[model samples]
Target chain A: MKLAYAIPAAGIAALTSAYASAETITIATVNNNDMVIMQELSDRFEEEHPDIELDWVVLEENVLRQRVTNDIATEGGQFDVMTIGTYEAPMWGERGWLEPLDDLPEDYQVDDLIKPVRDGLSHDGVLQALPFYAESSMMYYRTDLFEEHGIEMPDQPTWSEVRDWAEQLHDPDNDLAGICLRGKPGWGENMAFVSTLVNTFGGRWFDEDWNPELNSEEWQTAIEFYVELLGEYGPPGASSNGFNENQALFSSGKCAMWVDATSAAGRIYNPDESSVADDLGFAPAPVAETPKGSHWLWSWALAIPATSESKEAAKTFITWATSQEYVELVGEEEGWTSVPPGTRESTYANEKYQEAAPFADFVLNAIREADPTDSTLEPNPYLGVQFVGIPEFQSIGTQVGQQIAAALTGDRSVEDALNAVQRSVERDMERAGYLD
Target chain B: MSAVQTKRPWVGVLAWVIALIIFFPILWMVLTGFKTEADAIASPSLFFTPTLESYVEVQGRADYPKHAFNSITISLASTLLALLIAIPSAYAMAFLPTKRTKATLLWMLSTKMLPPVGVLMPIYLLSRDLGLLDTRTGLTIVYTMMNLPIVVWMLYTFFKDLPRDILEAGRMDGANTFQEVTLLLLPLSMPGIASTGLLSIILSWNEAFWSLNLTASKAAPLTAYIASFSSPEGLFWAKLSAASTMAIAPILIFGWMTQKQMVRGLTFGAVK
Candidate 1:
């Protein structure tokens, strides 16, 4: 009986001691390559701080967004750290859902972050999140195909030139499409590309008074051009293809040109991953009636949620993960080509990175030039080039994207789709009280 | 006899064709799991060197055994709990004839039609308030509630088909309600109960949405494990396939092993 009592007493004491010493911080992150690398390298952070344990909850992008948003809104205290984007950081920061990231150790060099990238993650002059990597849109084309076809791509091509190039290079008999673009129906999938197309074609989602302009002449022209281009020269089942599908198609030598996030440059230029790595060329994202908002600004960043009990430990981990030292560590451990790019100006200046990534300067210039605040041709009530930074934009954008995808798949006419998009947006804005 | 044999051969051939067609997607997934990432995305072709590289990478990246254990524990527990609650309710509805019994059964099923997302916030908040978030116990509870209606409905159907005379005889033999259910109803409805349990187990195992929302690292199951492979930048098709292959392997084996029993239970009342 004494032995049994002592055994239960010992177990209770052990459990109490174990609970008293260590602080485990849970981080909810997306399953992107850079975030995965961070997870792999997190052992160093754990080893350095023995008392602070790390628990990772990696989820897919949309699921991660949903989980984090649900947790933060309810103050469930499930996550200490969250991987959010430019769209959510500002909105959430303004709502005081995120912890302000203004205070950091001096050597962290917060100013080393690119202006546009950092600015996108800030709200009202306060930093809300630290950028893991930033990106802009650019055109990736096949150099060999262009050369063989005797076509010279300009430094900055117009949409008309791109269409003509696509027409000339299209070879359906050879199972090669002229261009691969995102057609998956999501707010961030097809709409991201479509919004830029509309912006460059002198259109906006909403005018200055928050009235939706989706049925405007500019939108009609842009939607018509998009459907015609993808329908004519795109691969079969293009409506189901998103960034990943298009990336796979482009990297496999099936696509002649792919206009997508500049962050894909690393994978597109890596010979191990891309079959056409040696035959790739880079150009600015295509323009139409205007140059404004031709490219989008986006940053995937790490932020501490207000509901965290382990805020300090989470902050420490975030600082370590997004620091310049982390960049150096990734470069040393995984080659220079695999280092997270477009976050810090110092990364572009590094001789090793510049040598490994020849398109660094081009990508950096595009990121610098993308202005989220003034992304539309007309005056608009929202920020974001590819997306509007309002909370309601997700559902609205996804609805419009589905309609646009219907048009792309020949399930609906462009005019009808745009009209439906306008009607939905109007209903949504009215429901959200954004419009009377 | 010769004419019957010829017709039987054609029926067998037709069955085989249908079975292969039904199985083609799984075969394609397993095949894609063995291909390199590049080759997986390459034009559909049967020729490619099979590699264990994706399996190696997937195992190295995630703790598969942990996720498998969670899947097993949560699924088995939820199914068992659902059976415990459902068997009694189904027995009552089948044997007892209250005027509201049918309406009550329909109402229970109607709750299933409401989208899981529609009540996600309230459930999430309730779970948090009750300190049930991220616990296997919490997940088992939600999954039990989520699958309870179906389990009840299935068991009710099976129990209804049971001969009312047997239960009536149990009462006539001076047995109480409990004794009647245990001695007469349960044993007689064993096959039906087994089928309901099997279905509940399968549904709980493959459920992703609630598991993804309600649980994080501590109690996450194989569904969450498979979801981790999907990235925003691109899908690693080969790795995703390998992860999926690993996730579904145990369930597939379990299903195959019990398929005979399941088929027997399903056909128990059909002929009669």
Candidate 2:
């Protein structure tokens, strides 16, 4: 009888020990380098808040988007914190799916966040997500090759001038292509670059009212130049290249120039990763008729879902992760070059970050100069520079991206591709009731 | 005998070539796992010095043992549950004919035609309501349901090939249905059952969609573990290849061990 009583007493103790003490919050994030670093240093947060435990669910980018969107939309309450992007933050926030981040601690320095980056993640002036790291597109070229060929790149080059340089520097016999650009067909893959191209060519996805302008003269000019430049001077099988593929191609000294995300500066400048690290140069994203949206603004931020039971604990973790102290910790441990960039004004202001990252000012200016609301020359309805803000834009953009990729591959003419894109976009907008 | 001997050597050469063609991608993956990140994407060369750095980094970054344990447990439990539910259904469908039996079997397969994404929302919501999300039990149940139709279909075909005379004789000897199944049918169809279980386990082991969607850290399997290496910036090919090699090794070994049984069972009724 004494033994039976002791067993029940021990069972109760075990049960209480498992459940009663601490709150556990699960964070669903993408598997990016900055997020990985945050995960590695999360033990500090756990130690500081002894009454709360943390769980991490790291997933790939596309998979993370799908899972987080599903969970939040269904109110499944699977993740307390979600790593979302500028594209989803405002849309989801406006839908009342995200908790407004209005009550952060005093030391969190919400005002120190870059204005454009901060604005991108807010819905009607209410912050929905905290920017962890942000980026804008730029041109990376080989200074050595430019000197060898006696070619001078402009501070802000035009698309026509860039094409001329490509024609001059392309040396297929020596196995070096003039340029490497994203040609793979996904909304985020090739269309990210293509959208910027269309913008600088004075093209918009829609007019004042919602009608697709894909078959406009400006779009045709932009796409024809893009396809001709990449086809004439790009490396073989360029149609299969995305950011990573083009990064690899450029880093190995196989491409003379690569126009891609400014986030690649760290990898490109690291001597261990790139063969041409010592000979690299930077310039603003090229333009033609305008520079209004010559570069894209993107930020991968963190937000708390409205369905989270541990909202307070989750907010504490987000504040800690995106804090200036966290930036200092990363700089100290991982080196200043590895610091997450484009989020905080203080990061760009730091002498050490400026010294370590040479392209810091250029990237910061580009991020600031990009105006998503007024991206195109004409009045438009979209709130994104590289993407459209509406939910239906994802499928529509991907369909148009495929048609553009086909033009690059020579399977279809540029005119035919744009016509098909216009038809598809009209169909999609009509189906989504965006078009009457 | 002389002509057969001459033909055998040429056939052996052809077989070796075909085998190599089929196995080259796995060989390349293992080799790339040993290369540096730059070397993996650089011009394909066979002369670089091999290193174990990627394997070290991959292991350092992830808890491989936890994911491996999850994969093993979920796959085995699902396979056992599928077998338990499939064997009786397949037996009844094979031995006891009814007018609607064929239609029922076809309908069961038609459920598979609907893409998993079409019903993903409802299933996700239901799992959340039931508090089944992120649990190993949840994954095992999903895997079992996903593989049940194929398991039942394979078992039915195998059971249909069995001689009805033996079952009738067992019935004549005063044996009931349970006794006949336990004593006579199971022993005679051991190979078939083993192969069906093996296929179910393999399918569940490599399943990524539901595992990625339904499970968080606690019950994530090797597929989810492999996916975590893919970043928005780019894939680290050497590290990805290293993780892939580790994730596939155990299942590859398990498949090798069951190869003979699978071959025998798959071809059992074909020759007759």
Candidate 3:
């Protein structure tokens, strides 16, 4: 009787201690494809590690940015793990909002990550986040359309050549647009495309002195060229179409060409998702006067917030989700096509992935060729491929994006829009103490 | 009158045309819900291959039932709480007016004019301190506060529209003050209360800004769920349309079921 009672008491104590030690980590992330895959595959991780539980806060990109920024900046302690990106990791890491992940377990192969992506996601010399998916911009076009129309696209086309091709293939009566590009009015929308255009046009967002250069002749020319090309051949309501809209357009066989994130290739080539999956061809992103900044680089990364009470558990989750084992698991379960790509070199080396992904060469080449440290044709005092790295870029870029959209819609002249952008950016720079 | 009557057929045709034009956007959205993203945004006229991929993607991406539960709880709780508070307050102002009653009511109404964003920072800090950032209780409170002025205003108008004779007659019959108001005033003003409550529910259900800003994961409602379908890269029109359809389905069904009550409450004792 005494032994039985002691055994039950000991069992109860163990249960109580287990309950007390249980940690629930809240992860805030954008609703991206890779993150969604991670969320779906997390049950296996949970089964293996019963001590930790995951709570997700999946939001749109802008909302996620706002939520994580506010929480981490204010030390609100709302989220344990945050899904950040190339744009945010270095900035946030420098601000101490993220915990350095340099001490990842040996099997994690911290060195195997693509160097440019790892460098972009690191602060000083410390890796702040592990990449989930990284990408550079590339061109996705309809091979069937090209063949049917007897048009040939070069491996590396110039902007003038692309312009001619767009004009040739544009058939408004047939309901097929020549090109699809992001024109929606947000910093990450039209401005993302426009920034690259500005780069290849031999224009920079700012001079060495941090002076606003929206009204520069090169920028003006680029803006005019963009408005003319999109206005003549782009689809109706193009001003409202962003990356997803453009993707839908391109995938539905409505667009002859699209230049955007290489990550989109997976979805565009997936037969289950896209109608033009088999009819697609890839090329380097089109360039203008300079090929220096023809494409932009980006990575979506998993990070542990400083506000997390369950930092260890959160780190464990991130490590597992972004680990090489997880990539292999995704491949075996969902097929090699669905494995998150561009984060690890070993993934590209895998024969199954290479064979499964037809657009593999374009994606890898784009990722390797993009140089974030030196993206502009003209000298600049900033470090971003598609965006200017400043606290004020969100507001500044948005204002300029609206102007560009307006210009495209014929609501304003390109000159007027550029002038407005110049004035507003100047004022912002002055306020930010960059215009001394 | 004779000339107008002669053109009545044309007028009727014109009326229907106007009505259809007005309803086209909603119809388009509904039609797009059944379309693949490509077909939905495609320029050519209606004939195309329609697919249910968007709906599947939207539903598969989210826990729709949980978001629906939050929507129901917050909207219903806020509506009920607002009604409970507004009834007595509106009654006191309508039947027993003080010198400051008009000023108080106007002042309360004016609070709605202050942009919610202006007060967001302070409220956010307060919510963080109170540990109410993403709880249903917090959402309910905020929703109640947001819809309170409109609720009180509607209730006040309905109460004022009622005749004082009913309450006086009840008092003369030896009923107590609580009984007189509850038994006499409430029953007679049922239409107004019903309409006001229904309107409050609609307002609370559709509110997105506060819910989006204040809540992150736990207390997120259908509006937040719908927003999650939006991608940073580009608009997945089919997915967006599908997400929108699912989000609005509950409210649409609710509105259909409660049409008669809504209409009755909307006009609520206005003529009499």
Q: Native contacts recovered, in order, as a fraction for each?
A: 0.51, 0.45, 0.34
Question: For model 2, how does the per-residue alpha-carbon lDDT over B179-264 read when each residue is reduced to its tens digit?
Answer: 98999888888889998988999999999999999997778889988988877664488888899999998888878877999898
Per-residue error for A260 in candidate 3, Å, reads 1.5
TM-score of predicted structure 1:
0.93
Off by over 4 Å in 1: A1-21, B1-7, B45-47
Residue A213 alpha-carbon offset, candidate 2, angstroms: 1.1
What interface RMSD does every candidate have? Answer: 7.0, 7.8, 10.5
Best by TM-score: 2
RMSD of 1: 4.4
Ranking by DockQ: 1, 2, 3
Q: What TM-score does chain A of each model score against the native chain A? A: 0.95, 0.95, 0.94
lDDT of 3 by residue, A1-436 (tens): 2432443355345434534456888888887777777888888998999899777778888888987887787677888888888888888898898988878999899888888888888888899998998888988888888898798887788888888889989998987898888899998888888999999999999989999899999999999999998889898889999888888788777898898888898888987668899898999999989998788888889999877788899889999988889999999988888898888889988899999998787788778777777889878888788888777898999999999999999999999999988998999999999987
- Compared with the true structure, what per-residue lDDT tens digits does model 2 show for residues A1-436? 2432443355345434545478989889988778888888888888899998877788888899888988888888888999999899999999999999987889999999999999999999999999999999999999999999898987788888888889988999998999899999998899999999999999999997899999999999999999999999999999899887898888889999889999999888988888899999999999999998889999999999999999999999999989899999999999998898999999999999999999999899999998878899998988999999999878888899999999999999999999998988898888888889
Clashing pairs in 3: A243-B233, A243-B234, A244-B234, A244-B235, A245-B235
**lDDT winner between candidates 2 and 3:** 2
- Candidate 1 residue B149 Cα shift, in angstroms, is 1.6
lDDT: worst 10-residue window of model 2 chain A: A1-10
